[model samples]
Target: MFDFAIVGGGIVGLSTGMAIYNRFPNAKVVVIEKEETVAEHQTGHNSGVIHSGIYYKPGSFKACFSRQGSQSMKEFCQKYDIDHEICGKVIVATKQEEIPLLENLYKRGLENRLDIQRIGSVELKEIEPHVKGLGAIRVPQAGIVNYRQVSEKFASIIEEHGGEIRLNTKVEKIHEESTGVTIEITRGTIKAGLVINCAGLHSDRVAYAAGYKTDMKILPFRGEYYKLKPEKRYLVKHLIYPVPNPKFPFLGVHFTRMISGEVDAGPNAVLSFKREGYRKTDFSAKDLAEALTYSGLWKMAGKFAKEGFDEYIRSFSMKQFTKSLQELILEIKEDDLIPAPAGVRAQAIRNDGNMVDDFHIIMGKRTIHVCNAPSPAATASIEIGKEIVNRIPKQMNLKESKESVQIIK
Candidate 1:
């Protein structure tokens, strides 16, 4: 039996696998991915921003991990000769009313001990030539890197360390026994001393399959993006963001200069009909039924009815989307944008209608389920991997090896 079997081959799972090998080099570790390759889901679809941890609550997993992960990720890239950039970003307060919120965010960034600067309009304009705002928070630590590349590197390191990565292997069921956990996959069953569920979009379902009861459900929210036309890309020098709506969980439509030099804008969050739905036309009957039937969704809808409606409007109307983006940069016109590939975020919502704002993990007998990890997850994958490895139950018989591999910086 393998010492550990990790489900989901996204960045988090791959990082966890790397962490396992780092902690116990002699232990047998297997990473199982349903897709043909690793990082095909959220990690592959990510915007590639190495978050600065400014927006997260202080002392939360999102805050701590992202703060530490940003530096560690940079070091990892440097060590592995991977391509990454520490290009700064600005959170602009377009309206006078948002200045308070901007100030609050600046304070939070300070509390998180980030290297952030509160700049006035002149400085904001100097940093981003076209962005219009009363004030902005310049976050120098925020950067961009292709997360798929990082995840692929993690997979390679795991393999080099003698861990196995099974691709095109979908996990159908998980049964835990006194001796080990029997995981039934598309091909066959495998026994493992422990299992780690990092199934991004289907995490809750995976936990449920293991007979673990949970009050929260994973709701898929599709974030559609529009890439700037090559000629119009000059408007955004770096990452430019508007003050996010305090009521909504998503960071509002923003402009991002990717590592590839292409600028993307306006990823408005809308409820998806399918878990993996990327386009407006894509629909799944079961996915829709589950979401529509969920009382938690209805409660959440009632709480933020107007904001939710606005998201749907922006999702369908290009003009509305452009208007939202215009709040950050007035030079961006509707003609300067082309629809880009969208990503679906797996946001966990509780029965009481509160979204799980922090990174959430649940430890069960012989299993550790990552119930909620989104946004900064790609940014904090390494630190999160270390955290998960640290959470491994002490009762599990780990190999006695004095020479532990150190993956962390």
Candidate 2:
């Protein structure tokens, strides 16, 4: 029996697997992913911005984890010789009213102990010359890195420590008992002394399968993107983000110079019919039915109806998308943008219609399920892994963990 069987091969799972093997040297840990490769879903499709934790509420999980995760991720990248940059990002304020909100974010950053500076239009011009803003917060510590590469490194470290990473192996069912948890996989059954459910996208289902009453439902929101034309790429020096809606975590569409040096704009949040749908036409009947039937989705839609409609407009109409971008860079036009790949966010929505804004996890007798982890999740994966590892002892101590003898035929 394995000491730990982590569900999901995304960044969170890989990081958790690495941490477990690191913490308990003698423990047998295995990470199982349904995809053929690691970081295929949320981890792979993100905007690659290493969050500074300024936007999150002080003392919140996202705030603490993201601040430390940025340092941890940067250190890991340095150790592994991965390509990364501490190239800062500016949160621009296009309107006068946004200045106070921008300053509020700066205060939050200070509370989080981040390296942040409030800059005026002159300094903003120095940072993003082509951008227009009344004022901005220059988070010097904000950086970027390829999380997929980081996930691959985590996988490598886990394997080096004699841990198992089973890709293309999907867990079909999870059964929990007093002794341990038995997971039925595509290959064969594995009895684990403890199971850590880091299954993104399908975390709710996995949690339910493990007999945990999930308080929220996962509603997929597709964030569509547009790549700036090569000639227009220079308009964005590094990363230029608009002041995010204080009510939501989705940073408004802005310009980002990726690690690969390509400039990508947009990522408007739209209700996705399919949980893992990357394209507009990609549909899953079951996924759609669940989203449509959920009162939480309807309620959330009603609350943010206008924002949702604008996102839809940007998703379909290039003109609307360009108009949004022009709010920051007036020189950009419709033809200056092209469609890029989109990302699906596994947003946790409660029945009461409130969005879970921080990192949420539930622990059982022999299982730990990470339920809600979005935006900063990629940045906070390492620290989040450490946090999850800390919880294992309370649920099931690997040093003393025992398992049932049930095996597959």
Candidate 3:
């Protein structure tokens, strides 16, 4: 029996596998991914932003882990000779009414002990030449990195430490035995002393398979993006995010300069017909039926009906998407925006239609289920992995569970 079996080969899973190895050198660990390669879903499609942890509540997991993970992630990259940049990002306030919200965000940043500063329009113009904002909060710590490359490195390190990584392995069922759990995958069955379900989009389903009473469902929200035409790439210098809607979970449409130097704009959030749906036409009957029959989905729809409708409009209409971008950059026209690949966020929504704002991790008898880990998860992956490893019982540890966190920095 493997000491630990980790489902999902995304950044979180690979990170967990590496953390387990670092914590328990003699323990046999295995990572199973349904995809042909690691990080094929959420981690692969990551926006490549190293979140600054400024938006999360102070002392929250999102804030603390991101703060730590951002540093640790950069260290791992540097050690492995990966490409990364610490260029800053700005949250611009285009309207006077957004100033208060921006100020609140700045306060939250200070509470989280971030190196945040409020910049006036003059400073904002100095940073992003074409951007227009009355005021802004410049988060100097925020940067960008290719999370997919990081995930691959994590996989390599796990294997180097005697861990096995199984690819094209689809976990169909998980049965908890008295001593351990028997996981039934596409290839065969495997026994594991402990199972870590870091299944990004399919986490709830995987947990339910293990008989965990999950009161939530994973609702996939597709964030459609438009890449700036080559000639229009000059419109955005770095990342220019608009003041997000306080009521919503998604960061509103904005411009982001990727690590490859491609400028992308306007990833309007809309419901996906399938869990892994990347295209608007991609639909799954099972996924659609589950979403349609869910009371939580309806409740969420009812609450954000107007905003949801607007997102749908932007999803199909380039003009509507360009309009959202124009709120920050006036020179952006529909012609300058080209269709880019979309990413689906596995946002966990409670039965009451309330979205899970915090990280939802459930520890069962012999398994740990990561039910919900939304945005910034890539940025916080290393810290998240350490936390998961730390949660294991002392008796189960190969050495000592109380080992101090080894910082790569």
Candidate 4:
């Protein structure tokens, strides 16, 4: 029997595996991934922005882990010699009314204790010449990196430390009781002392199977992006974003300069047909049935009808997407945008129509289920894993080593 069985192979799962291995070096640990490789879901399809905890609530898990993860992630990258960049991102306010909202974000950044500065149009031009904004907040701590690379490196470290990572092994069901837990995978039954569910898009299903009642159901929101044409690649210097509307759940469509030197324009969040659906035609009967049956989704749609309508429009019409982008840069035309890959976020929404805004984790007898961890979860994976490891019972520690584990943030 393995000491610990981790469900999912995304950044969170792999990081959690590494954390457990670090704590109990001799203990047997195994990570089960349904897909063929790690980070092939949300972590793979992400925009690759290293968030600075600016938008998260102060004192929240998202803020704490994100801040700590930012530093620790950079450290891990440096130690392993991974390719990453600390290029700053700018939150721009193009409308006069948005100035106040931008200021509010700046205040939140201060509360989060981030290194940021509010600048005028002149200062903004000094960094991103092609970008336009009346006022903006420059978050110097924000950066970008391919999370897929990070997850792969984490798996390597886990194996080097005597952990097992099994891919292409879909977890069919989970049975947990007082005598540890039994995970039923496609291959065979694996008995584990503990189970950690980090199944990104399918996390809720896994949790429900493990006998955890969740008020919220996972809703798939597909964010479709467009890459800037080769000639217009110089349109963005760092990252150019429009001040977000406070009521909406998503950050408005904006421009992001990927670490690969390609400028991407998009990520308009719209309802998706399938949970992992990257294309329009991709559909899953089981995933779709759960979504339609959930009353919370309808309630959410009713509450944000206007935003939903706008998102649907942008999802189908390229002109509408360009129009939204026009708020940040006037020179961007419809022709400058091309079909970029899309990513679907597994946003957890409660029965009352309220989306779980913070990082949520539910602990059980021998299991820890990560029900809701999106967006900044990738950026904060390291710190979040550390926090999870700290929460594990001290009795799980088998090593006689007396070295104190440093817990930052």
Per-model TM-score, in order, reads: 0.98, 0.96, 0.97, 0.97
lDDT tens digits, residue span 220-244, model 2: 9898899988888888887889999
In candidate 3, stretches whose alpha carbon ends up further than 4 angstroms from where it belongs are 400-409
Candidate 2: list runs displaced more than 4 Å.
394-409
List clashing residue pairs in candidate 3: none
Total residue pair clashes for candidate 1:
0
Model 4 stretches with alpha carbons more than 4 Å out: 395-397, 400-409
Task: Report the C-alpha lDDT of model 1 over 1-409, residue by residue, as the tens digit.
Answer: 8999999999999999998888888889999999999999888999999999998899999999999999989999989988999899999999999999999999999999998999999999899988899999999989999999999999999999899999999889999888789999999998999999999999998999899979999999999999999989888888998888887888999988898999889699999999988888889999899998999999999999999999999988999999998888887888999989999999999998889999999998999999999789999999999899999998887864555546655
Ranking by TM-score: 1, 3, 4, 2
Which of candidates 2 and 3 is the stronger one according to lDDT? 3
Model 4 lDDT per residue over 1-409, tens place: 9889999999999989888766676778999998888999899998998888988889999898888888888877777787888988999999899988999999999999999999999999898887778989998878888889999998998898788989899888889877678999898899998899999888899998898889998999999999999899888888888888899989989898888998889888887889999998999998889899999999998989999999989999999999999988889999998899999999999999989998889988888989999779999998878777777755554672244242122
lDDT of 3 by residue, 107-214 (tens): 999999899899999999999999989999998888888888888888988888789999999999999977889999998898999999999899999998899978
Which model scores highest in lDDT? 1
Cand. 1 TM to true fold: 0.98
- Top candidate (TM-score): 1
Clashes of each: 0, 0, 0, 0
Q: Give the true-structure RMSD of model 1.
A: 1.1
